[model samples]
Structure formats: C-alpha cells, structure tokens
Target: MKALDRAELQRRFPEGVPVQCGKSSSSHLVSPNEIFAVESKMFFLVGPVGVILSFLSGGVFVYSNWSNVLGDDLAFLFLVPIIILIPWLIAYTFIKNERARISLFNRHYI
Candidate 1:
C-alpha cells in the first residue's frame, strides 16, 4: 500500500483511523482502517500466531517435563489438558472479539 498524505487521510477517514503498527521493527501503518476492519484483521493475523505459539510452548514444556510428569500420578492428564485449553480459550476470545469489533465497526463506519 502507498503512503497517504494528510489531506488524503482526512478525506478518507474524517472521524478517525485505526492503525496497527509493529514496534521495534521497520513497520508503519500504510493505511488506516475502520476500528472494526483493523480489529478483524488483527484477529485474522495475530490469532493464529498466538494459538500456534501457545501450543508449541506447551508441547515443549510437556516434552521436557515428561520424566517428572510420569514419576507422579496421572497429573499429566489434568495438566496437559489445561495447558492446551488455556490458549484455545484465549484464541477463541480473540476471534469472538474480532468478529464483534468488525461487526460494530461495520455498523458505524460503513
């Protein structure tokens, strides 16, 4: 996307523009979206990454702690499921919120 001039931004988004920008990276908001569009995009982009990372981290922890786990009772059955579930809850929340945000943004912005 091309950079927008001040005049263009004002013209395009008179109310306000939502921008998502990465920190500590060479990133900039190329354009602004309605709050809803930005939020939906956030869900589409960041939700999966969060889910995958959580699963990977949980797997690594489970693998590294297998010896300790088995030495105990069926603690793993409880612990492992919890570990998997927490991330799912978080991702599900993001997705639901994203959908809501998008819907609300569309209702007002569009």
Candidate 2:
C-alpha cells in the first residue's frame, strides 16, 4: 500500500494514530485504552514457531505409527490431518497478525 505524507496522515487521523510498540514522543502519545487494545490485538504473534511445532507434532504422530498397527487404520489416517488442522489455523492466524503488525509499524510508526 502507498504511504501518505504527514499532512495526509494528520488530515486522516487528527487525533493521532495509536502506536502499539516503540517509544512515545511529544507528537505521539499512548493512551491506556489504546495500549490495552493493541496488547490484546498483539496476542497472536507466534509466527512460524507455531507452524513448526504443529508440523513437528504431525511428524511425531507419523513416526509413532510407522511401525505400529495404528498406521493401518483408515480412521487414523483421515483423523490425523483433521486433528492437526485445528492447530494449523491458530498458527496461521498468529503468523498473519504478526506480519501485519510489523508492516504497519514499519510503514507508519517508524
């Protein structure tokens, strides 16, 4: 996205934009509510770590079943993907929000 100039920013958000991370200055003030909101919003920032862990769990599951009778079960094969998919979504949300926050901070707050 194209970045707007200071004048445009001032015109767009006359009250000033609330920054979640970084130091506050005379021009940038942090409000308690804004801070709370930002912190809450930042809760999902696990990124690739979550994804890696999810994959690792899948790997362990596959390895455990490789030499066992469970591997032959059709239900187990179908359920493993579905089971890991729940955690994958959590990981995905975390990664996406983290990237978005980083981009927003770099583009506007720096």
Candidate 3:
C-alpha cells in the first residue's frame, strides 16, 4: 500500500483517522484496523508457535512426571487433556478475533 497523505486518509476513511501508529515503526494510520494489520506478527507468536510450544511443554511435563501421575491414582493425569486442549482454545480465539478484526478493515491485507 502507498503512504496516505492527510487529505487522502480523510477522503478514504471519512469516519475517522488515528494520529499515529507503531512505536518503533511510526506512521500515520487511516483507521484503527491498521493497528491489527501492523501488529499481525503477534498471530504467529501466539498462534502456531505458542500451540507447538504448549504441546511440547505439556508432553515433557507428562513424560518427566509420569510416575507421580500414576502415584496420584490418575489425578495428576487429568491435566493432560487440559494441556492438550489449551492450544486449540488459544488458536481458536486468535482465529475468531482475527476474523472480527478483518471485518473492520477498509481493505484486506492478505
């Protein structure tokens, strides 16, 4: 996308405009939806990477502490399902929020 001047921004997004966007990569934004577009890097970190790490961490925890789990008569074992589902929950939430954010965008990023 091209950089928008104040007049173009006002004409394009007549509802409103944001004064500035991005702390490290500062620029004017035509709309708040731009924030989501600019900050989309978080999706990878909290989505796929986070899900993978959570599964790996959960596996390690279950493996290293298997005996304790059995010793507790499967009480500690209950955590396994929660650990497994947490990634799906996180991913679903991010996807849902992304869909909502996309609906607000004046133009599509991808």
Candidate 4:
C-alpha cells in the first residue's frame, strides 16, 4: 500500500488519531487503546520484567529441548536474527513516537 502524505492525514482526521506507526494507513489512525496495548507489551518485554521472563522461559525451553536448543553446532546462529530484530524494533518505536510528538500535539498536521 502507498504511504499517506502529511496533508492527507490531517484532512482525514481533523481531530487526529492517538498514534501512528508510519505513513501506512494500516498502522496509522490508531486509537489510544491500541497505543496502550503496544506500550504494555513493551513494558512486559523490556527491562527487569523481560530479563526475568527470558530466564524463566529460556530455562524451561532448554530443559525440555536441550538437544534442539544447544546440541546442534549451528544453534548459536539464532542469535543473529534476534540481534537484528532488536535494533529494528527500537528504531521503529522511535519513529512512531517522533511522528506522534510532532503531529499529535501540534496545531497542524505533520
């Protein structure tokens, strides 16, 4: 799908939407509840909570599937995609927040 221009978003929602992931229509025009959901997930998936859960889940998974997880010589390669995904998610989150900060509170659409 095509990305919506700044002018079009304003024209579409005069009052405005809560947050937008991007210029893409599917992620934009978001409601406050939707934003809250994402925030909650991030909260649970980050910081101390994330660390604890990671350890617990990692332990369980490793216990149940030790061979599948660590027996293979190439098992460590899984870290590659996870490393790439982390920065990408962070950047995307920042982009969405910047977009909201610049436009959601401004008098004019950005």
Ranking of predictions according to lDDT: 3, 1, 2, 4
Residues 1-110 of candidate 1: C-alpha lDDT, one tens digit per residue: 22223444546766555454667455333433423244436667776787788788789878988887768657766877788778789889867866675565455422
Report clashes for each candidate as comma-separated counts.
0, 0, 0, 0
Residue 26, candidate 3: C-alpha displacement in angstroms: 17
The estimated TM-scores of all candidates read: 0.51, 0.42, 0.50, 0.30
From the highest TM-score down, the ranking of the candidates is 1, 3, 2, 4
**Candidate 2 lDDT, tens digit per residue, 1-110?**
22233444455556765554446443554332232112234444554556677778888887778764344677777756876686778766766775676455445532
Best by TM-score: 1
Clashing pairs in 3: none
How high is the CA lDDT of each candidate model?
Answer: 0.62, 0.55, 0.64, 0.49
Q: List the residue pairs that clash in candidate 4.
A: none
Candidate No. with top lDDT: 3
Off by over 4 Å in 4: 1-71, 107-110
Q: Which stretches of candidate 2 lie over 4 Å from their true place?
A: 1-24, 27-45, 68-71, 92-110
Which one wins by TM-score: 1 or 4?
1
Which has the better lDDT: candidate 2, or candidate 4? 2
For model 4, where is the 10-residue window of minimal lDDT?
31-40
TM-score of 4: 0.30
* Per-residue lDDT of candidate 4, residues 1-98 (tens digit): 11234455555656656453556645445532222211224533454554455556556655666666666746545754464455556656765775
Over the full model, what C-alpha lDDT does candidate 4 score relative to the true structure? Answer: 0.49
Task: Provide the RMSD of all predictions against the true structure, rounded to 1 decimal.
Answer: 9.1, 8.5, 7.8, 11.2
In the range 4-97, model 3's lDDT, one tens digit per residue, is 2334545666775655545666655355334333335677676777778888988898898888876856766778878878888878887787
